[model samples]
Target: MPSGKGQGEPFKLEPFQKLFIRAVYEPQLKLRRVVRRAILSMARKNGKTALIAAIVLAHLVGPEAIVHGEIYSAANDRDQAAIVYKFARQMVDLDPELGQMIELVPSTKTMIARRTGSVYRAISAEAGTKHGYLPSLVIYDELAQAKNRDLYDVLDTSFGARDEPLFIVISTQSNDPEHIMSKLIDDGISGVDPAIVCHLYAADEECELGDEKQWHKANPALAKFRDYEDLATSIRKAIRMPAEEPKVRNLFLNQRVSPHASLISRAEWKACAGESKLQDGEEVYLSLDLSSTVDLTALMIGSVSDPCRIEPHFWKPRDKLIEHSSRDFGSGSHRYREWAEAGRLHDSPGKTINPEAVALFIAEMSQRYRIKGMAYDRWHMDYILREFDRIGLQAYEDCEKGGDGLRLVPWGQGYRDMGPAIDALELAVIERQLIHPNNPVLNWNMANAVATSDPAGNRKLDKDKARFRIDGAVALSMLLGLRARDRNIKPVDIEALIG
Candidate 1:
């Protein structure tokens, strides 16, 4: 049924598909095209496999063929890997000309063109340690589902000897924005590299779930590829089952939402973003989130002024920056590299954040800015306090600076304390009162943040099910919480939010 083998309707390229092909294959002043990679991403049931089959056929024996060229269609598993192969095989069988030239070997999930001696094989991530294959073109299907990037790295590197190698990735999005596919999609969408061609067809995240008008954004083949009545049935079922909403959004709308939701929406956080930053001699309140040695450690500095201007000092081990971004788990594929290049992220020496460096940095900030002392979690305050002593900067335990020394106030991480902090940040965002340098790291943390609440409706930042590091946002909120508390500005009514 997936192959549509007996369907009388001929396989033809849609306008969208044709445009993608032209962008990928069309040459410029030179004979070879500029693009080395093409990413075609959309929702399911979009005739992706059929379009892929056509491209495979063209390269195997038709217009794009070359002698002994090796082509591979890869997926996360064998079953998915064989899809394009099966489609191409059935198409070959339908035409006498193709049947005469192409040899189908179902057992191996391979097709060979007799005329050109070119070979196409279906491979998957399970087939690890693939080596010594000179690939002219590698088609990765649903690459976002891969458990790791090993298979992709191998196949990509194998194209080293080819003159004009092309790597084609066709898939939906990954819920984790750090996945390799997600990174590629972001880069492609950003147009960071002109050598990469990307075509994405997906509905907006805020689009009405069952709205038929918005369906075409994600499904270019809505009517021609599948019966509209059947799609409507699926939509109706999903609407009735609230639990099925995530599935519908992920699979049908092609959104990046996972099982857990973000604490603050991107639009909400972006709304409060400003170019405002810390000023010399400006009164500053600080929050220090000292994470583990290998994790991110953040410091948020903000003024108590009406339009609360803020800045951050975020540090990670210089050595682990790239490794952190490329990991399969925990905030993989973040734009750490880009942020680092832009001087937005600070790199500490070696493989761990130096507490002495952090303490020294704090002392330095005190010289330029008047202090309201720094709020800190007790989790790793000893390390920082010890560093302060080593640098001859006395870290006082009071809220305001005492005897020209640094003030370190305790900020608990539990709901009892963080509940107000969370409320304060939310209120500031709603009122457009907080301003920051629009730091990418802070923005990312805010987007990944999620909140958990107690029976009394007291809430705290939930890192357990959160997308990734939320230290910066937590710290930002703590400073805002302190501002409201110290200034006796009436706190956000927790009962109102709870009620």
Candidate 2:
């Protein structure tokens, strides 16, 4: 007997639930959008479906609602769409009050409001299904897994017709930075809105990777629905030997797991550095890493003609890298700020650099050499995107969807394929197929890299995951692989493009 003043008792709201109700009903709230985003991040199995069902019932039966009102619940897959429908059905079955308010068409998995003639339908996101319906409210579930993402375009078109239409998108975090769900989460968190969006997420940066206590925060239902002790044991086993990437990321961190672990140790990766300068007639491929902190900004180039060989063209530590460091750097006793003042290395202009200046540098250098393509992680690299857009530089955007024209090479698979690439490079060096002018800084950076693997057997550098990272070693490898893949170079490319 859940306590409620209705014909059939209503479900009790949690602390977060009360907060969510206020977000939904209080139009006077100035920060309604912000509050809603917070609600979106509530842990899974915290009665999400029940809450949604209750909201639907109110819209259908409440006196203020419009007649023949349309509501839609959408998920990335048909199976997931059924889950929400099941909740609505269960509510109708359990509660005598809610049951009287609606007529369920069980065959179609739809609910029809008797007085208002409103309808609620469960929809799976398909290529163009959303285009035909003018829904008063639409729920997007598991948006991260949407196969085509055409639902976004259709929803955009439909939204213009209704003044007070409600849109809700909920999904677990996904690894693909390009995913539509991820974009929504990012936009919601940044307070970018015409649509009110909300997100709930694990505090990834603050939480220990495999700590069970921390895991429970993001998965509140672990004790009730899952075996908490078993989960803890599994996590412990994952990191114990070979350092499994999947169990660490997926189970604990709630991030997409990298597919494979590396054959080579991080220490071994650190030993594979070579020179930076390109030999005569050698075509180069560039990979860039834009600095977020006063971190290192690197541009690594690899020779495409000889798959086994790679070289670094640029490695500049932003003025901030060593600015606060307690360690001494050789005879140059002056601080990192001193290097910036002397114009020896580029310093961050302030919190960020002038996009135009950065663009000009890339474009100018690109023109000066026979570069195939520039590959970079777009995460936290918006400055680069804007700069490239402004400068008329050819860049790959929406590459997975075939809009960008430039080929997109995936990482994570790099570690698995690096051994072959390394062998090829070694052979190239012996055969004189590869040649370079030695650059000590590039060599130094390469000597500091580490490698790790995922369950799928893909491999990537552990530098991003490690406490100590090399200057630009990871970036160098990325550029080399990108160039090779772009050229359709055989036998030496990372397996991600093929498989």
Top candidate when judged by lDDT against the true structure? 1
Predicted candidate 2 versus true structure: per-residue lDDT over 56-87, tens digit per residue: 66667764266778887777667777888887
Question: What TM-score do all the candidates reach, one by one?
Answer: 0.87, 0.52
* lDDT per residue as tens, model 1, 446-474: 86788888897889999897767888988
lDDT: worst 10-residue window of model 1: 328-337
lDDT of each: 0.81, 0.55
Worst 10 residues of 2 by lDDT: 324-333
Model 2 alpha-carbon miss at residue 390, Å:
31
